[model samples]
Target: MKMKKVQEILEAHIWAGEEDLEGEVYAACGCDLMSDVLAFAKEKVLLLTGLVNPQVIRTAEMLDIRAIVFVRGKEPSKEMIEMANHKGMIILSTQEPLYMACGKLYAAGLMCESED
Candidate 1:
């Protein structure tokens, strides 16, 4: 799915990297464990995480994740947003829980690495 459509589907607020929202996201991975993200996430995927910190941004950069959806209204720190912006990673926040957000996006045709 396109990042814009994912934002709409999740009723997300774009917190950073707004200019890059038009890009495509072939898959998604929802997890709070940074190790799991680093181990499994593929390129151009959207990361849905609740762990709000600079390390989340760092993980996304390492995986070449195209976007991040902060679940259950979790917000990123200033440094995290700045890092995401610099890496061209679109950041979004939603009130939905991580599982719900992931399900909604999956139904909308976004899958995880395993599903693909």
Candidate 2:
């Protein structure tokens, strides 16, 4: 699914990278543990987490994430948003809890592509 459609599913607000929203994301992984995020996320992934920090954006950059959704109404710092824009990443914020957001995306057919 596209970032716009994911945003609608989560009832989210565009925090940054609004211009860079026209991108595709096939899989989604929602977790607060940075280690798991780094290990599990693959290409064109939509990352949903409550962790708001510069490192989150940095990790997303490292993993080549297509977009980020800050769940549970959490918001990232201005610096983080700027960093995400610089890295050409889309940032989204939603009030839904992490599990709820992930569930919605999965139910909407944004299933993660496995290597099976």
Candidate 2 per-residue lDDT over residues 20-96, each given as its tens digit: 76688888888888899887778888889999999899898998886899999999899998898788889999999
Clash totals for all candidate models: 0, 0
Candidate 1 backbone collisions, by pair:
none
**Among these predicted structures, which one has the highest TM-score?**
1
Please identify model 2 stretches exceeding 4 Å from their true place. 113-116
Looking at candidate 2, the ten consecutive residues that score lowest on lDDT are: 107-116
At residue 103, candidate 2 shows an lDDT of 85
lDDT against the true structure, per candidate, is: 0.88, 0.87
Q: Model 1 Cα displacement at 29 (Å)?
A: 0.3
Best by lDDT: 1
Cα lDDT tens digits, model 1, 1-116, are 88889999999999997887789988889999999999988887889989999989888887778789999999888888888888878999999999999999988888776665
